[model samples]
Target: MFEPVIAPSGTLLGLLQRGRGDGTLHALAAPRAAALTALNQCVLHDPRHDWQVENRSLYYARLFLDLGGGLEDIEAHLFGPGDDPDADETRTGLALSVLGHLASYGRDDALALLRGYAATGANWAWALDELALRDDDAGLRSLAGAVLGRFPATREGDAALAAAVRDAFEPRPWRLWAEDRRVSVGGRVRAARESGSFDRWQRQMRPTGPRPDWSVQSVFDWAQRGADGGSALHVPAARCLGAVAGPDDRPLIVETARSGPDGARCAALHYLAEAGDPAVLDLVETAVADSSRTVADAAVAAFERMCGEAAVDRARGWVHRPDALGASAAGVLACRGGGQDEELVLGALRETVRADGPDAPLLWALADGAGRLGIGCAAPVLRHIYRETSSSQLRGRTARALAATDPSFATGFAVECLWDCEETTREVAALHAETRDARVAERLRRLAADPAEEAEVQTAVRSRIVPQSPPF
Candidate 1:
């Protein structure tokens, strides 16, 4: 997938594309033509950084409903000339999702569109999955022939059908087909189901990696071999070590942590760190300074996993170092440190943003630390990161930080955050956004009523609007 061109933080389209709550407020206030145009752009293009996790379908669907928008743009986009339905699902997943939400909102046209697409669209499975949640039995049943016909009466086709049945995100439609009265439909589906079951069982029975009875040396060797093959099997190999390694095997483990092959070294560090070996911190610090970037990264990650008091003490001492270990140390402290370590965390946050800019990977931990520590002075920095950072996940973390630190959050970013592309951010907005703003109350009501809204978000909305009974 290509990186989407995000609009400047100032524009209404940018705000809507960013999934900001203020975007919704602004769009509602703007001319309906302008609002629908912007909403259509988002629905057709999909502005989310991570479509699978971030939410825009419900937000856009609600906007379409409010605008009384027709489905022509979406329909044309889905069935447009040269559009490959069988290509990557990213192209049409957002549009299909939006239609799903619209259908849930009682849009018969949207329902019809989904039914039509499921019968012939390239990404028919995704459309079928969406319909499985909302479409009636008759609507689903009618499409069985078209869907089943996609697979031919051959071994390869039957195998593909079994894979599809096995991997389906929603099984209601397949289950329904399995019970169909038609021999062609029900029989084929049943055979596919059986094949899928056997496939799963065969997979379970297949031997993979070292077994529990494998020697520690053998496990490390397996890890080394996997590493040689360009696979990072050390993570699971470390788990195998836990099962296989005994008291006398500490020497071998430590040897690997000190200077083993890249894969074995990585696995050993992970094992020792998770085992909470007292000497693991120093070993990690040493590994972080190693010449190999892979070893250094593994070391840093292993160190961060160390949540003991000793690890915090080590972080305090190493926070001043200007290297990957220093950054990881600060992150460890930020995540696991207490109020006493606030200054260290703050120093790291400012320095990281200064050196690496808002998009720095380290800022995620530092931002969360700022929030957990209630560093009121860090709100400005958090807000800057929130606006300038292209990462929605990072922006969500920044929103959480601002909520804890920014006193004006209830009316400021919190309101805009209600429409944030990330559900967690919207949940934050629902929990904290002041209802005094006219839009907040209405948004909450719409959220409460929208069948497509996330349950957590709606639950948060209900908590705000539904009055609590007085204590006895």
Candidate 2:
């Protein structure tokens, strides 16, 4: 995936790109033309740090509804000149998802667009899946010819059709087509279904990876093979070691962790750390000092996995150091340290933001730790991260941390958070956002009635609303 170009956090585009709640508030307050332009930019070129994980479709769709926006930009983006539907789904998946949400909200234009795309789009499977969730049987039945026509009657075509049936995310449309007498697809669909089931069975029957009888050396060899192939297998190989190694194998395991080949050393370190070997801490410290980044990263990861008091004690001693191990020790304290370690966690939170800015990967764990520890003083830092970070997932976590520590959350971020991209963030808003504001109450009512909202978010909304108000 290409690295997304995130605008400055102060701009409306940046706020929207980050999926911050304030983006919706600002967009609504801005001139309609500018807002629509920014909104179109976001929907047309997804700004999510990881589109597969971060949520923006529903948020953008809701904005469209509020703005009374048209689907012209979306249509142009989906079916524009030079656009390749057969290309990576990432290119068009976000737009399709936005359209799907819009359809759920009873947008006839959105539904029509989806029906058109599924029949001819290269990413027809994705569009079909969207229709499966929202379209009627008639709407789905109309697409069988176009969808099935993708495969010819040749043997290779049949094989491709079977694979499509087997890998489909939604079988509703396919099943309906297979059962409908009016549609001529019944015979072919039934054959494809049977072939797909057989393909699944054949794949499951094929055995791969380490068996229960694997020896420690065998596990090491497997890890080495994965390393040579550029895949990391040390974590699983370490688990395999746990199953196979005996009391007599301690010395060899220790030696492997100390001076073996890279793959074996990493695996041995993970195994020893998980086993809580008394000498594992020193070995981890030594491995951290190693020159190879892979070995050092593995060593730090192994150290962080440790949950014993011994690990905590070592963390306190190492937390002040400036190396990666020190950063990891701070994280350990943030995750597993006691009340006394609160200051260290806060300091680490600040230092990380100051040193690497809010988008640092380490902030995710540290942000959770801040909330878990109830560090009230960390509120300012948490708020900064919530606003400036381009990652929606991280912003959601930071919002949680803020709710736990910031007293103004109920009146501040919580109100805007009701419109945040991530459902979990919105859920937090529903639970804590003060209902004193008319906007909060209206949003609560709307969310409670919206069929597209998550069940958890709806439940949270209902909890905040009066029970006597039937059907929201």
Candidate 3:
């Protein structure tokens, strides 16, 4: 997949791409044509940095409803010349999902579009999953012939069918077809279902990897062999060392950490760090400077896993080092440090944003630390990350942090957060947003009534709104 180019945070298109609630508010107030153009672009292009995890379909679908948009753009994109439905799900998954939400909201055009795409689209399975949730029995039953026809009666086709049945995100459509009396789909589907189940069981029964009783040296050798084969097994191998290594093995383990082969040294560092061996910290410092980046990374990871006071004390001393170890030390303090470390955590948060920009991975832990430590002055930088970071998950974390540190949160970001793509952000809004705003109360009612809203969000909404009186 190609990397998405996000617009500047100030632009309407950029806000929409970020799935910010403000995008929806802005789109509703802007010229309908301009808003629809930007909205359509986002849906068709799939702007999420990580499509599999970040949410956008619901956010977009609601905007479409408010804008009174048609499905013409979506249909054109799905079936346009040069577009391959089966090429990659990411290309069409967001559009299909938006149509699914529209169908649930009682849009006949959306439902019909989904049905048409499921019959002939390359990403038919995604459409079929959407139909499974909203379509009635007859609607799904009608799809049996078009869908099943894709798999021929040949051996390879049957195998393909079995795999589809095995991995389907929704089984309702398949189950309905299995019970259909009008076609041969029943027997074939039943066989596929059985085959899929047996295949799953067989996979479970297959054994791989080293057994639990292997000696420490044997485990190290296995890890080295795996490294040679292009798979890193040192992590699990380090666990094996925990089971096999006794006091007598300590000297050997320490020596391995000091000068053994790359794989063994990595494993020994992890094991020794977990054991909190007195000599491990010095060894970790050396490994961080090792010629091998792999060993250096392993050493940093091993040190981060240490939870003892010794590790925290070491983290304070190493936090200023201008290397990967220093970065890891900042993360450790962010997660486990006390009030004394607040300034250091804030400094790291500032430096990471300045050095790597708002989307830097290190900002995740530092953002959390800013909130946890109640660093009030970090609010501006947190706000910067919240607005410019393309990651929805990271943005949500920033929202939580802002709630703790920003005094203006309840009336500012909180109001717009009610429309955020992430439920966690909406829950935060529900708990803290100023209900005096007309939009906040209206959204809270809709969320309270919408069956699809998450349980946590609804619970938060209930806390703010009085219970409705039953009909007299």
Task: Give the alpha carbon lDDT tens digit for every residue of 27-146 in model 2.
Answer: 999999999999989998889878878999999999999999999988988887636854668778899999999999999999999999999887889999999999999999999999
Reference-based TM-score of each model: 0.93, 0.95, 0.96
Which 10 residues in a row give candidate 1 its minimum summed lDDT?
207-216
Tens-digit lDDT string for candidate 1 (1-472): 6678888878878888877767777898999998889888888888877786677888788778878999999889888774685467888999999899899989999999999888878888989999999999988999999999999989999999999999999999999999997889999999999999999999899957444348998888888888898888888988899898999999989988999999999999999998999878889988987998989998888888887899999999999999988988899988999999998998998888899998798999999999999998888889888887767788899999999999998989888887776789989999999998998898889779876678999999999996769999
lDDT: which candidate is best?
3
Superposition error at 404 for model 2 (Å) = 1.3
lDDT of each: 0.88, 0.91, 0.92
Error of 3 at 127 (Å): 1.3
From the highest lDDT down, the ranking of the candidates is: 3, 2, 1
Which is superior by lDDT, 1 or 3?
3
Question: In candidate 3, where is summed lDDT lowest over 10 consecutive residues?
Answer: 207-216
The local lDDT score (0 to 100) that residue 279 gets in candidate 3 is 99
Error of 3 at 450 (Å): 1.9
